[model samples]
Target: MLARSIIFLLLSLSACPLFAQQKYIMTVRGKVKADAIGRTLAHEHIVTNFIGAATVVDVPGDDSVVIAKILPQLLRLKGQGINTLIECTPNFIGRNPALLKKLSELSDLNIVTNTGLYSAVDKKYLPPYAFTENAAGIASRWEAEWTNGIGGTGIRPGFIKLGAGSSALDSIEAKMLAAAILLSRKSLLPIAIHSGSGQAAISAFEQLKKSNWKPEKLIWVHAQNGTDEERAMLANEGVWISLDGVSEKSWEQYAGMILFLKKRNMLHRLLISHDDGWAVLENGSYNKLDLFENGNSIPYSTLFTKLLPALKKAGVTESEIDMILRNNTGDCFSF
Candidate 1:
């Protein structure tokens, strides 16, 4: 009887899922459990060279120049208890997986990068080949990156980064969004779309719904660009509303936005970030994006440094703060 009981116990233990507690968020190096990701800074650009190399804005075309400029800023983020940064530079702009891997190693931060293409206002940023690819074709490309790692770097993307016009998605943007929806349905990875405007989010959600994708998987990046009513609409539908671009100049505005979600009891769906970072190489150039020169106070540390306290002072509880800064992002990026 003892032997039989031992055998049954062993079988039951073997059948149980290991790593059940670790829901992974893909980074430049590899995957880290969503909870392990620690105080995350969602929606940032580690390397961004999307606009034409207009030889003017002191674009550090060299890797060394990029690294020298940004590592200190990242070190500051680490000092402030931030462990993970969601680098949102997409393809055709400045998404470099390898450099991101290097930065992760150097900074000891879990850096989650993304797959998917950016939309061209007039097909400007998109490569010529993008015009030829249909939604499925484009989706296949992104899916392969998610499955097999991006561009032979062995670094997989954690989420899909998509963009659109403020009012509506253009033809190419629509096709790419469709492709993203297809991939999201297949893989169950989260999709972060730059909500250029309220109409863009509505239109994209409509199409995604037709495809039978869950609204929970969609993230409205730059959601603050829309009005309160528009944001409420998206937040009500169970999508993520990212109010990332906060500075001392705008923390109150974001606090108000948080309050907006709180009143609706949908604060868990909110994601906060700086949406700003230093970049070079037109993507992950390792150059820090310093929006805080000459008394501009939009540093990456605002979430921990300023915003959290303000949120608390504005009547947000500690648990709610954790929900926004940690749990919400962990839940959003996890598969």
Candidate 2:
């Protein structure tokens, strides 16, 4: 009787959601429990290169200079209570997993990276193979990155990052979205698309439905680009709406959007961040880093310093703010 009781207790505990069904969020260092990431910035970048994918190459000695420039910014962000930052720079646009890993360790911040190709900006960031490869073939490449780790760095991506133009998904963007759906289905990772407009977001969401993908797993990044009606429509359809471009100049705009969603009771579907980062520049024979001209003079600090206070002043309760910054972010990226 004693032995049977002990066995049953052990089995019950093993079958509990906290054990058998544990959810995790992958970061550059490794996997962590979903709830462990606190006060996450869902969309941000570390460094980016706009030199076009055709001729862009990672300079061998640029890592040190990058660290020197960006690490202090991250440390300051850490000081402001940001526990995790989802680095949005895709592969060709300076997605440096190894550098992100080192920064994560040094800053003691959980940094998440992504797997996917960028198809916006007239497909300038896309590699030649992206055009040649079929949807399945492109998905296979992203899957391999997810499975084997990106660039053999032993660091896996936590989500899929993609981009599309303002009008609609062009053929290549459509193919990229199809591949993202395939990979998301296989890996259960969320897809964050840099949508340029409401129409573009609608186009992608429609495609996702046709593929039978879960709407909750699709994050419409830059949802601020869409109207309140469009945001509400997509949020009602269970898509995660990311208003990531919060800056000092745009806090009122963001506050209005947040209040709009809050009035509609769609705050649970919302995520916010300052889409801030540094851009790599070519100067003479050496590479230089420049702050992105996004109007946030400080990278990663506007949300806490400017937006949060404004949201609070506008009657957003602490719990609701927490939901947007912590809960929604964790749920959107966790698998």
State each model's CA lDDT, in order: 0.79, 0.91
How close to the true structure is residue 46 of candidate 2, measured as C-alpha lDDT? 88
Cα-based RMSD of candidate 2: 3.2
lDDT of 2 by residue, 260-306 (tens): 99999999999998889988786211248889999988788888888
The stretch of ten residues in a row with the least summed lDDT in candidate 2 is 278-287
TM-score for all predictions?
0.86, 0.93
Candidate 1 residue lDDT tens string, 141-167: 999999999877788999998878887
> Any runs in candidate 1 off by more than 4 Å, and if so which?
1-22, 53-62, 279-298
- Cα lDDT for residue 188, candidate 1: 78
lDDT of 2 at 239: 98
